[model samples]
Target: MQKSYEEILEEFSENLKVLRKKQGLSQEFVAGIELSVRNYQKIEAAISTPSLRTILIIADGLGIHPRELFDIPSLKNRPMVKEITTRNRKSAKKKTTKK
Candidate 1:
């Protein structure tokens, strides 16, 4: 079945939030890609839909392919992505602290 528009938006928001946090980045940093902090916040909050250009800029800022932002296979997919992101963040923190 096709996902609803709202579902896609919500998934995108969750994915963006997880990806940003996993990189230990601030909203301001992602906002600098091509938008204001308020706009970026709206995007992550699912309050506003982003244009393809904005998505590309965000993907570039996050250092990931744009496709990753929309790769949800199912509703259950988000939690798995979030779990991996959390683990990656923890591992990165450990590496940083070790230095």
Candidate 2:
């Protein structure tokens, strides 16, 4: 059977864990520079998907490009765009506001 999106995310998360550990960085250290402990744990636990910013943060923490997080060979075939801007967040929030 083909893998679902969740499955692909799980693989990405696992790859990140191995990469982070290989760099000898603890989760706490990564969380400090990247994301909250709860959020980081969720990424590892596959409870919540990571955003582009989170991926960039993790990549920076690991001293690698964000694209390296993907383990699937196919994923590398396409360009991964990691766009993180405060404007996007604000626009998303604005969409939910009562007119």
Top candidate by lDDT: 1
Clash count of each predicted structure: 0, 0
lDDT of 1 by residue, 1-99 (tens): 557779889988999999999999998898784788999999999999999999998888888999889876555545666899999999999999999
Evaluate candidate 2 by giving its C-alpha RMSD to the native, one decimal.
9.9
Query: What are the lDDT figures for the candidates, one per model?
Result: 0.87, 0.77
Q: What is the C-alpha RMSD of each candidate to the true structure, in Å?
A: 13.3, 9.9
TM-score of each: 0.69, 0.68
For candidate 1, the 10 contiguous residues with the lowest summed lDDT are 72-81
Q: How accurate is candidate 1 locally (lDDT)?
A: 0.87
Q: What C-alpha lDDT does candidate 2 achieve relative to the native structure?
A: 0.77
Top TM-score prediction, candidate number:
1
Off by over 4 Å in 2: 73-99
Model 2 poorest 10 in a row by lDDT = 75-84
The sequence of per-residue lDDT tens digits that candidate 2 reaches over residues 1-99 is: 356678788888888788888888888787775489889989977888988888888778777887788866445433332234556777888999956
